[model samples]
Target: MNADEVLAIYNDLAAENVPVWIDGGWCVDALLGKQTREHADLDIAVAREHAERLRELFARWGYQPQPRQDATDWNYVVATGSGSTVDVHVFEFDDEGNNTYGIEYPKDSLTGTGVIAGRKVRCIAAEWMFRFKTAYTPQDKDLEDVRALGERYGFKVPATHRRPAPRL
Candidate 1:
């Protein structure tokens, strides 16, 4: 999805009092305070309890639920009748407010909150985003995101990320 569409969706959900955190590439852009590239889908994380409401909202927008993959926390994809899909990650938080095991957000990982295109948003903490991106085998886009985060916020990407050193 493009940035405007992403912002529109967040605004609509916010109007209904649904809380969501931006994740994946858009998330990396959010952390960097701008859109760095085009994104195929929006990645969002919401409290597990809100999954039903999210599904309903997307359904109203002409999205249908697709089957979730086995052994992944990803709840489902909301696909437009035209086949465009948005990935939704449903996560349960513990009584202590920790995102449950295998869920992406760690306790205290939401470091910055603000409004983007009039939609309020909470961004994945820079450190955690760096850690999360590093876990996978690096793609060119992933490396670009890591470098952008580092350049913008002085965030250091850990050695575990399979990306080569950022160009000087």
Candidate 2:
């Protein structure tokens, strides 16, 4: 998705008062205050209470769930006929801020805000994104994002995130 499209989606969610925390690659770009790469889809985390409402909202926009073998109640992708898709991760928190259902996102991970196209929006924090990216063997894009995020935020990029030289 492009920046405008991202902002448009954010605007719509905001208009409907749907709380969403931007996640995945888009979250990294949002934290950086710029778009670093083209995004295939937007990722967002929402409170479990709002999941059904979100589905209804997207239904108005003609988005339907794209069947995935791994699909679960907590996570899935919704797509429009126009090719735009939003990957939704649902979670719930107890009074003490611990996750109690759906995705096990830590409460602190949702406390970040970033500017996207000059509009401040909620997103996954850079530190959390860094941790998530490094928790697995990094993809080339993950490595690139980690490098950039480390440079911008003064974190140490793990050696495992280093991209190997292309074969000649």
Q: Considering every candidate listed, which one attains the maximal lDDT?
A: 2
* Alpha-carbon lDDT, every model: 0.75, 0.89
Worst 10 residues of 2 by lDDT: 157-166
Candidate 1 structure quality by residue, lDDT tens digits, 1-168: 887888878888888888788878888887766677888888888887777788889989998777755535445677786656778877777898877744657767666564455555886777777778877888888888887877777777666543654898
Against the true structure, what is every candidate's RMSD? 3.1, 1.5
Best by TM-score: 2
Q: Model 2: how far is 20 from its true place, Å?
A: 0.4
The per-prediction tally of clashing pairs is 0, 0
Model 1 Cα RMSD, 1 decimal: 3.1
- Model 2 regions lying over 4 Å from their true place: 165-168
> Which tens-of-lDDT digit does each residue in 4-116 have in candidate 2?
88888889988998989999999998889988898999999999888888999999989999999999989999999889999999999999998999888988889888888
